[model samples]
Target chain A: MMNYGIIPISHLQLAMSIILVLMAGLVSAFLKLGLLKSLIWGTIRAFIQLSLIGYLLAYIFQINHFILILLIMLLMCYIAAREATRRVNVPTQEPLLVSFLSLTASSLLVSVIVVTLIITPRPWYSAQIWIPIFGMILGNSMNGISLALDRMYNEVRSHTAEIEALLCFGASPWEAVKNSVRKALRAGMTPTINSLMVVGLVTLPGMMTGQILAGADPREAVRYQFVVMVMITASAALGCLLLIGISYRKMFTEDLALTEDMRQSHN
Target chain B: MEVFFQFTQITHQFAPNGPFIHASGSLQPGKALAVQGPSGAGKSTLLRILARLIKPTSGTVIYQDQNWQAIPPRYWRRKIHYLPQKPVMFEGTVRDNLKLPFELDLLGKEGSLDLDKAKLLLTEVGLPLASLDHDARTLSGGEAARVALVRSLLIDPEILLLDEPTAFLDTETGKKVLMYLANWLQNKKNRGLLLVSHKENNLAFFPGMQAVVIQSEGTRG
Candidate 1:
């Protein structure tokens, strides 16, 4: 029973999810929240949501529905955007909108392109393959955009004069921000890069390890990780590009000077 | 050819709920305008307004015969630079910071000084030519202030706004910085300075440079 694959993975995930919700409830209790209510409410929500998602995924795998796969892809992006919005510093909220747009457009484009053109999954829009793969891609892209937005905003704020001075002198807004932009992009992508480097050597990634334990051949597991990692990297890159380009306007004026709202929000 | 900047009835209040910190004042260009006041006075605010770093609550800043409102701010910003009470040290080398004022797009299009002129300006301020090759973060306070001043002037802006540039310097260093500025203003015959300082001796350093004691407005004590 311990060695069994899907059962162990599901049990572990359930336990971990329960523990996290419990911890959140406990923390909320100390903060004078309705602790018992949240604990019960949160556990139920997670169980239902995950159970429904699990059945839905099974249905998707059997049906191989393209429309359903696209919908799921979009849903993942929407959730990712929501998560990212909770973390950024733009007070007026255009930055949040840009983040959402970037996450949706970039992750979708990259996932579709890579999955279709490169991986060439049989049936092309196969839901079983697309949903899980898109999930990883969109999730990481969300993290990337969130981190990049936070960094770019902070950098622009603290170095306001310098950035303006650069713009005044002749640097295009993009050129003026090339340093910060590159740094933001690098910051957003670094974690994924580091995790990819250590994945098989340090610890098997959840998906690959799950598949291997579920009796898939080691070679097959490696192939899937290879495809997933490439997809994730592509998604992260596209996400950063979209975020920087689209959100660049919010940080600067039409003249491309850094704005006061961006500068003073932290204070 | 004419005045570099003109401030007309410019006022700024830092706190929306607080009393007006800066009453309106009209200042002409090509003349030294000294902003002297108590700590809470808006000397810094006024200077920032001239630099267009901070917009005034009311009134206008005219530069090069056109009102500041009409000009593209980035275009005006190219010609305007403010030295804060504490100038920020941008990351990287000393050469990096000194080279900054030149990096403005305006300088690139209209024209900018070569390295030799920059070195001369640095030397006049008593900063070593070797400073141009080192990191900015390592510099002492007085040294950084001197560097900030030199860099601001390097852009050749018609109007200059300085806030407590000499605060961190000793008597000798402060005088040297002031004297260099006075000489530069005289040499250029047009570029004016709005300096905010408390040092009485510093006032004497630029005789031809006009002075205004803001606290002199009221408060007999």
Candidate 2:
């Protein structure tokens, strides 16, 4: 059987990619974009997690088990929910669980539809294709959820007076939370929008980079990246929309107030 | 008249060596506390604890004979709005700032957004009705501070705990805000106000007003 792992050249590229990511992180730390410890911990966690994921994928590819693939994707999504709540100042379990449920459900359906009806890959559980694509989409959703939650919590605390005004005037907690939720959704989706706005013009995206590196035709790579971009957009939109639109009511009480301790819950 | 607000046995240390470490005092409600300490003396923290924004290390704060913690913080916060020493205004129109807590979510709702309420608050805070549409970021320090205060008052809490709310305002603006607050609190319908200020203003403005000096020791951030 042919090798499923990357070529030697790809190994070199991966090493360089890791180094560059670390460097970029260090620079941001120096610039105080946020806490330095956060970057350090994030890098360490990402490295260990991704490495384990790499080994797991290799094993998953050999088995070709649909149940295993489904199970792994669910696990990845569970971790993603934890990530979404990591930096938030709100109670994470409910929202994080909600976000994870939506991300997994939507991404699974979309990926299944795309791969089966559209892409038509042989052996539907082909780890090579479904895994990478799901990784990108679910990862995007994680970041989107993270930003949305942080923004939502902050907006609530900062605008207490305005919130109270609404509550006093007979606005339900949902009614009170409406503005903050919208702002959070907007804030979370901003990076996606900007990337979409400047894609191809600003930078070649990750998918395109991978395709080009794989020695695919430039046109083929562009097409793949285009499809992937649309998928990502759909994924991110669906994740945010479902979580923001549908699940928030369960997070808070009928009075529009947070149902539980909305604090960061000690990291 | 004397300060009615009281903070008995209030002991707070934000951090081991941080400034504003030690503070203990009492101010009769509806009275002003002129925190005249060099740099920091736990004045803000004291105010924060009273407002239920921060909890004290160990102490009892009797707000009408009710343990501050026993009451829901939101209820206390609703009645006792905390205005920090520095005013932080959000990014939006003056009207947006006034309606900020609801604008985003109430988009499709019926009759929740009230323009009239916003204008009346602006006027109450001494801003013209036209200022409602003014950009929040473009407002001067004095204007922002006033808007911030009005925003806090929007909740209609029964107690006002200001932390150096007038530190950024011009003397004229500061005087006006102080006067308005004094007059508002004097009305039996209004809640008691515990204003934190350092400027030289006549203490006799409020009938039941007295100043509690925050003694600054080495314990301050």
Candidate 3:
């Protein structure tokens, strides 16, 4: 038991973590598996990273400054945008701008709605309440944009002949690519939709389980989880739509020609 | 006859400093030009470059005595239609496929699909009019080829760049397609066709047609 009226695994109990790793280590050694070293190193890495994050989060939570929270949110979005755009194959003046704009727009919109209208986290910029929720939705939205952009670029390559046929027949670039864009949107949404369907029945979601383990009321935890799921789903869809809308123009030129970079990238 | 289109010092390659293809030619109205080459000789690339679907590493395509690059690609593509080697069909009825051009803002005012005209084209191409209602995906290779050709013709392009339009058809069907294409040109005075094919027999369909054989130059130096 710890100070917050919740069960805590003591630093001494971290020996339990070592015990679990040792079990895996013993199995690997007996099987002559090559992964024993990787498993050991992975455990050490996880321990260090999680410990650092835990301390940092505790310090942030104690201070609870609105400006600090806002700045941290901006930092999260910047990292998310950078991670997402790295997967996009098209060359643009600023690929980061597309990801950043979409991610920030969708994340901010959802967070404002959730904090003000739904949860009403007292200080509203409450880092303890908003940060974790913001991180989850922003992370998912980043993934959605990445997947959508990847599929969109691929469809542009695979459907070159069809797209050219449409263009030759006087269809605008937008008109020609509408179908491919639809396919990309669907591809981006599939994971979220599938997860939504299996969420409670197949697996207890991360937020709900975390809350329950932290000694929060079960009913309140379920409500928070529900709001979070909806926020994430909405953010992901908007992120995909916004990213594709903004970046699709980069696929072609002012003269309505598909850029040479787009044609040559994947081929 | 005036030169309807011209390509000057056009060069393209898959990689930088790689084995590139060089093509230079002129197409006049009411004339036919056939591109001959073995597979991978860049016959398709030549047509695509002329169409501006792909940019050449170095070259200029002039249309109507004007630099092609200066002209908007959309307008240029309207005059020059490039058909790929493999015919593509959208998910719809054959009639829907033919009506595709009309769906575009530029061509929408051209009126809806003319069923009588479609039937006439189908009959000319030896396809049953009933095939108009069949799902495009259900079409055989030869039927799909004819549909793709007819769909392009619906736009009434000035220059037709066809890559082996009859590659998948039987001899009888191929001859009919050639004759239809000939009639298409005969009806319009300032029209030309640039065809890429391996078979020389198809050339006889266009008398006095100029032949340009594409030979791959292994290296620049």
Candidate 4:
């Protein structure tokens, strides 16, 4: 029902993009907000990062080596995990490992199932199919897990008395924070659920828009979007559960005591 | 008489090198120990240590002639109940609070609410049977403390760790609660009660109770 073709941007047209950023910088300068330098640096960083990723993708797409693709995905997961850890208030030694395991476990499983079982992209490791879908799922899962971890930590810290009371009343660590974990999982899944409710109504999502621009059939694009939406929701739930489930052990000692030192150590 | 619990020089400080003396004590069955100290003397920390809720920097807690490390914390908690100074109340009826212990794994599948026993305990604490249906969140501090005491008592712990349980109650109510508590202990043999109270003079009221005074080692002078 809509135009499915898009005109490609030329190098000269891309260079002209600086004008829009400069206009934004001018507004900041005019308002004396002192954000002009930050705007310029941010624009420069985005330019460099996008350009580098574009060139990297082009090369990887040509080779299409399975190991290389796997390596890149691993790197993406590591970066995502580190980014998540940086956002959380409490510093734990296992967050990077936890994030990597949860993201890779959920996203890769869903992606593999979708690709090999569902879509069955030719050659199986098709960079175009593997990279974009996995990236979207991993990024969404990382956000959900990060928010969930933060919520769990804050809840435990704020309600130490209540949790300890439960513990004193013969609750194990799992039993003590069971309600908190449930709350965290709900917090993680809410975003994906909300997005699903208003997907095409509020605005066309980025993946669907990209597919249409690349001349994909509207029906085919819708099918892909539907699969992705479900996969993301699954990945988020799994990621939050695994992250909280694994990391919650660190909240208590081997002796199963919730000590004052344990609380301070986490903070 | 069996030494129910033994604390070997338990010490706790905010930091590893922080200036604070270690807390050392022990308790046996059918006896009450009153933990008295000035402000900031880690009296609450001492009770938490005994409750197994806190692990002192360098000490060992022995229970029933066995190392505390050998016993599971959940099981330890069942035998030794810790009632915090400020009780935490969930958003529900007083009956819901009494039903918490039955919901824990330590009690296992055999755990079930005894509404009749719960009502009897409320009556003993001078609360009407109607209090069972009252909202826990709306109950006064004194009422909450009594409810917490009843909740712990229902478990029938070997050692009951009380942290200023009567601080929020009026003089009359506090006396009634303490007498009820003392009488409750006398009824059960080999039951230990460790209370942390600022009311030093009231420690004499409980017969056969020992006074263990903890000084802060001049950390705050």
Give the winner by TM-score. 4
lDDT per prediction? 0.73, 0.67, 0.85, 0.82
Question: Which pairs clash in the backbone of model 3?
Answer: none
Q: Tell me the lDDT of model 3 at B13.
A: 80
Q: Individual DockQ of the candidates? A: 0.29, 0.06, 0.65, 0.80
> Chain A only: TM-score of every candidate?
0.80, 0.75, 0.92, 0.92
Stretches off by above 4 angstroms in model 4 are A1-6, A259-267, B218-221
Candidate 3 Cα errors over 4 Å, as ranges? A1-4, A85-97, A253-255, A260-267, B37-39, B212-216, B219-221
lDDT string, candidate 3, B46-75, tens digits: 888788777788888877788987887877
lDDT of 2 by residue, A11-37 (tens): 667677777767878888878787667
Candidate 3 lDDT? 0.85
Best by lDDT: 3
Write one digit per residue (lDDT tens) for candidate 4, span B1-221.
56777777787665556656476667767778888888778888788877777666778888778898888888888888888899888768999988987888777565687888888888888888998899999999889988988898888888888999889888888888888788877888778888999886567668878777775664632
lDDT of 2 at A61: 89
Which of the predicted structures, 1 or 4, would earn the higher DockQ when compared with the native?
4
Q: Is the docking of candidate 1 incorrect, acceptable, medium or high quality?
A: acceptable
Per-residue lDDT for A1-267 in model 1, tens only? 233444455666767766777778788888987677867887798789989988988877998877877777777777788888786756774766787789888777877887788778788888866777778888888888888888988777777766654654445677677788888889888888888889889988888887877877778878988878877887888899889888877666654556568657311
Candidates sorted by DockQ, best first: 4, 3, 1, 2
lDDT of 4 at A224: 86
Q: Number of clashing residue pairs in every model?
A: 7, 24, 0, 0
TM-score of chain A of 4: 0.92
What is the full ranking by TM-score, best candidate first?
A: 4, 3, 1, 2
Kindly state the number of residue pairs that clash in model 2.
24
- Which candidate model has the greater TM-score, 1 or 2? 1
Q: What TM-scores do the predictions have?
A: 0.83, 0.60, 0.90, 0.95
- Report the CAPRI category for model 4: medium
